[model samples]
Target: MEWDIAKKDFKRYLLLERNLSNHSIDAYLNDVQKLEAYCSFKKTALAQVDARFIQQFLVFINDFSISAFTQARLLSGLRTFFAFLQIEYDRKDNPTELVESPRLNRKIPTVLNIEEIDALIAAIDLSTLEGMRNKTILEVLYGCGLRVSELVTLKVSNLYLDVEFVKVEGKGSKERLIPIGHHAIKYLKIYLEEVRPHVPVQMGHEDVVFLNRRGKQLTRVMVFLIIKDLAKKIGLTKPISPHTFRHSFASHLVEGGADLRAVQDMLGHESITTTEIYTHIDKDYLQSVITQYHPRS
Candidate 1:
């Protein structure tokens, strides 16, 4: 088979046969595509390519203004692609086995302090209809620490108010039960009972948990807009987005002594290592810790 044919089969296997999640498959394919693009940039094709070509691809990617993390992931993707070729294509040898990911220094995510989160939440007026929707959006986003896609795709049917939990279909269609705080649950109930009913329902989006006035599913862009506007109204100087709330959620939990593994499970992280960055400490917090615990203090 041609190189493209085998590549296509590998993608299908990752998706249908292996039941890999779309996000995972996308990462792998994007890596392969980046390699292809790098080659095209140099006027070469995959069939004639080998390890030296991949090393060059890595160096080329590094030369750009990219993070070590991004470069490392790209290297991983290319490595997997070549390995797949060796096994499925019956190649002579695996060419990418020696490739190394760039070394990375872990950085903690920025988060809104509890007071700041409270201020942001307080800034929302419960009296207005838009206020109601925005309030519910904020609660659920931070309360569950969900990615924007998961939050927007949340449905009315997944809500289990009696159990104080909501079902979320996370990365790879993996389902997790996230506890909904009573405060958030109260607002969500308000949105469901009072607000969602008034919005004009778009045909297929009837089940969507968050909707625009048109009752269509809230786009990622809309969620971003909501967060930006809310932050602006509250005069929050830090960069905030729908995802920021998730980071804040995880950070706050970690700071409160929630176990990292437990937070990972709630966040639907496949690996604990991926969730460990939430434990990153800021300079101010470190100073406070030193003063509180040191006998010299």
Candidate 2:
């Protein structure tokens, strides 16, 4: 099969069968395209490629000094692609099946303490309309443990404030209901009732929860910039982004003895292993306490 045909079929499978998000589909397609380019350089056909060719492609990418994490992600995408070809085209073998992914060290995410979170919120100038809206944004981010994409696309219709839950569309378009905190509900009500109505609602953005001054839905970059500005305002030296709030939300819950499965559900993680990283954070915190306060030196 031609590379282009294989890629098109793979994309269709990802969308129709796997239900992956557009961002994820694009990443998978990009990985296949990279392999296609490498094959073109080596005068190889997609149908003729084998496990040895796949290993050679890995060597080529590794020569560029890409990080092991990125290499592993690329290999994962290729594995999915070849598996698709194997199922649909009745291929005799999948080249990526024999290839092993690069070993990676999982990095622990940075988290904000309760005092720092409070200070970040306090640093907002609530006298202005934008300040109130920004405050609500931060509250929902920390309170809901939402991804930046989820936060930006949040809709007014999905917020069940009376029941204290917000419906979130996570990866693969899977929806989950996250319990909203009272503080988030309070600020969200203020923003929706007092601040949002005052702004001119754009035609298509009427249902959007957060808006820019121009009456359009807020972008992911806008949320990141807001968090960066807040971190700077509070003089926080830790490099933080919108994801820091999510990490803090999960880590704090785990430290407070919240169940792992419950935290996993709230965070919309498909696997408990992904959520278990917060337990490591909790252990690190305990180790710090022991190192600092324990008298048995």
Candidate 3:
């Protein structure tokens, strides 16, 4: 089969069979395209690719000094693509089956302390319309442990404020109910009832919770800039983003003795291993506490 036809088939398989989100589908296709480009340069067909060719592609990518994590992710994407070829197109062998993925070091995520979170929130000027909305944004992000994508796509219909829970659509379009804290719910009500209604919402974005001044849905980049501006205002030197709030939420929960499984559910992690990173953050916190208090010096 031609590379274009194979990729088109792969896209359909990812969407219909795998039920992956558009963003994830794009990433997988991009990874496969890189290999296709390499094949084109080598004058080889997709069906003719072997394990040796796969290794050569890896070496070529490694020449650019990409991070091991990215290399591993690319390899994973290629494996899925080749797997699709084998299953649908009746390819004889999987090139990635013999190729080993690069080992990745698990880097601990940056987390903000409770004081820092409070400071960031307190720095927001609540007098203006956008200020109230921005405060609510930060509250929901920190309180719900939501991804930026989830936060932006949050809907009014999904919020069960009386029950103090919000439904979040997580990775792979999986839905989970997260219990909202008093602070998040309080501000959420303020935004939805008082602040949001005043703004003229554009067509088709009526269900979206957060809206810009244009009455349209807020993009992920806008949320990041809001957080970035707040961090700068607070003089926080740490490199932080929307994900930092999520990390802080999970890390604080683990530090406060919350159940591992419970944290996993709230974070919408597919595997317990993915949630275990917060435990490592907790360990670092504990080590610091002991070092600061203990008279070992």
Candidate 4:
């Protein structure tokens, strides 16, 4: 019942039984680590920890001023862990079962308008090899609405340029084929034909679609930095990351009257509700159309 052993077993359960992705498993383990740290600070053992101990840990985390969404996610992780302990280990009780998550505000995601997206891309030099790769990266990110991790892990074999679709290995290793736009395909062809061929491929990364200067797979951090630099270069006031293009992609599609289910499939969202957020982002467009065309308006 030691914290270390408990975390290891929980991770195994998540991997083997739940079949969660590494990103999700890491998040759950991070929550457990937080609890373990709190327990250490209080000189308490896992076996002796109770609901009160969990509540105290919440208070400790609250002092750090994390967002409500983050707090809720952490609590969800803790609840899952304690439930696993109760069911699998035959623990008498679950400490986090009754613990409530923080009330979450529906914060709208930041989305770039078509003009902003264009401006960002237009700012790229496209003269150097890295610039060409960066342009392709932005094009694919916006065109396919890919997650940063998916973009990094994208392989050459998965691309079906003839059919204009790329097989994306999404969350939980789920595979979905997303149609690539003409612009994305055009830039990808240029990068592949003109730039990427010049770089020597590393041993294990021969098939990786994007690579670092060293001929290795590009890291997620590298992608973030690239986007950050571009945003700064263009004097974009709103903070943005790689995910901004994804949000923008969905928003623009919804505004253009794309079906929610179709957008959901494209984005690899397991739930329609996650895709529904794009509808909210398109509310202004919906209202404008109604106001102009509807007799009642």
Candidate 5:
């Protein structure tokens, strides 16, 4: 099969069989395109390609000066593509099977303290129509540790405020029930009942929880801009996005002695290892723990 045809079929496989997100599928396709370009440069056909050619392609990309994390991600995509080929076309061997991903450095995300969070919320001017909605968004983001996508696409029907939980549709269309804080619930009620009712909601967004002044659902960029404006207003120097709230949520919970497994469930992390990064406790908290529990104390 030609590279284009194989790549097309691989995309379908990712959608139907792997159930990967559009973002993930795009990344995988980009990797395949890179390989196809390499093949063209070497004057090789997909049918005549071998493990050596794939290795050379990897070397070519490495020379382009991409970060190790990106290189590893690209290699992972290649491995998945080759595995798909092996299963579908009855290929004898997978070229990427033996390929090693580069060692990655896990960068810890920035975390905000409770006082900083309070200052952010305090800076919101609740008199404005959009202020109420923005407040609710920030509350839900920090309160639930939800991804920005999950927050933006949140539906009114998904909220179980009486039970203090909302159903979140996370990556891979996986749904998890996350407990909502009383503050989030209170602000959400105010936004839905008082502010949102005044806006003429656009069609097809009737069930959407958050809407812009145009009555349309808010976009991811809108949320980022909202947070950016708020950070600048308060003169807060830390670089933050909607995700900073999420990281702070997990970090605060870990600092407050919440169980790792429970935090994992709330954050909808698929693995406990993924949740472990949030365990970076504050120095004061660590010292307090030592003083409170250590026999030497």
Candidate 6:
């Protein structure tokens, strides 16, 4: 089939069979479209494309100075798209099955210390409506370890605040229950009760947990901007984003003696190894533990 026809088939599988959300279906299609873009540029087509061509594209991405992470994601996305094709059309095997992803070097993400987190939260003045919402946003994000997308899409029905847990649909549309702290829950109640009712919401987003001044759902960029503004206000010199809270959430738990596997489950990570990458060991804290419990010192 031509690439356009193949794309339509993939789109149907994603929407009807897989029952993916519009956002998710769009993303998966966009991934496949990247390959199509490459083919168009090179005056080739997907049906005639081969593994070596894919490899060349990977190298070409590097030549254009694409980040290894971006390169890896594009390859992984293509791999899944081809896998989906293999299932739909039983005539051919997947070419991407044995292809290597971009060689990625692991780097520990920057984390917010407990004190810095407190400062960031404190910087949110609770007098204005936006302040209340901002405070609530920061608390819930750090408390629940939510991705920006998850936070923006959160609905009133998903919150089981009475039970100290909230249901979050994460990447790949995976659902997980994450624990919320009492402090976070407290501020969230305040925002829900006081500020949220005041915002002028659009028709479809009334049930959304967070809202802008106009009562519409927040964009990912809004979350990013919120965090950036908070960082500037608090004189935070390190790089950060909405994802910083997630990194801090996992890191703080590990540092507080939470089991690595437990952290993995809470973070909704597919592998413990991915979760392990978030740990930031404080040598002074480690030494303090040893000093207090040494048999002979």
Reference-based TM-score, model 5: 0.90
Query: Model 5: per-residue lDDT, tens digit, 69-127?
Result: 88888888888888888898887888877777788878889888888888888899998
The sequence of per-residue lDDT tens digits that candidate 1 reaches over residues 1-297 is 455686688798788766788889988888877777777789886777877887887788778888888887777777777777877777776667777678888765668888888888888888888889998898889898999999999988999999999999987787899988898899899889998889999899988999888779989998898788778988999988888999999988987899998999899988899898888766798899989999997
lDDT of 2 by residue, 1-297 (tens): 787788888999999999999999999999999999999999999899999999999999999999999999999998888888889999888888888889888899999899999999999999988999999999999999999989988999999999999998999999999999999999999999999998998899999999999899999998899889988887899999999999999998998899999999999998999999988646666889999999993
Error of 6 at 281 (Å): 2.7
Top candidate when judged by TM-score against the true structure = 2
Question: Model 3: per-residue lDDT, tens digit, 96-127?
Answer: 99999999878899999999999999999999
Error of 3 at 239 (Å): 1.0
Give the TM-score comparing model 6 with the true structure, all chains together: 0.80
- lDDT (C-alpha) at residue 139 in model 5: 93
* Model 2 / residue 150 / CA error / Å: 1.1
Query: What TM-score does prediction 3 earn?
Result: 0.90
Off by over 4 Å in 1: 18-27, 34-49, 61-67, 292-297
User: How many residue pairs clash in each candidate at the backbone level?
Assistant: 0, 0, 0, 0, 0, 0
- Runs of candidate 4 exceeding 4 Å displacement: 1-5, 36-53, 64-66, 91-93, 281-297
Error of 5 at 124 (Å): 0.7
| Highest-scoring model, lDDT | 3
Per-model TM-score on C-alpha atoms: 0.88, 0.93, 0.90, 0.82, 0.90, 0.80
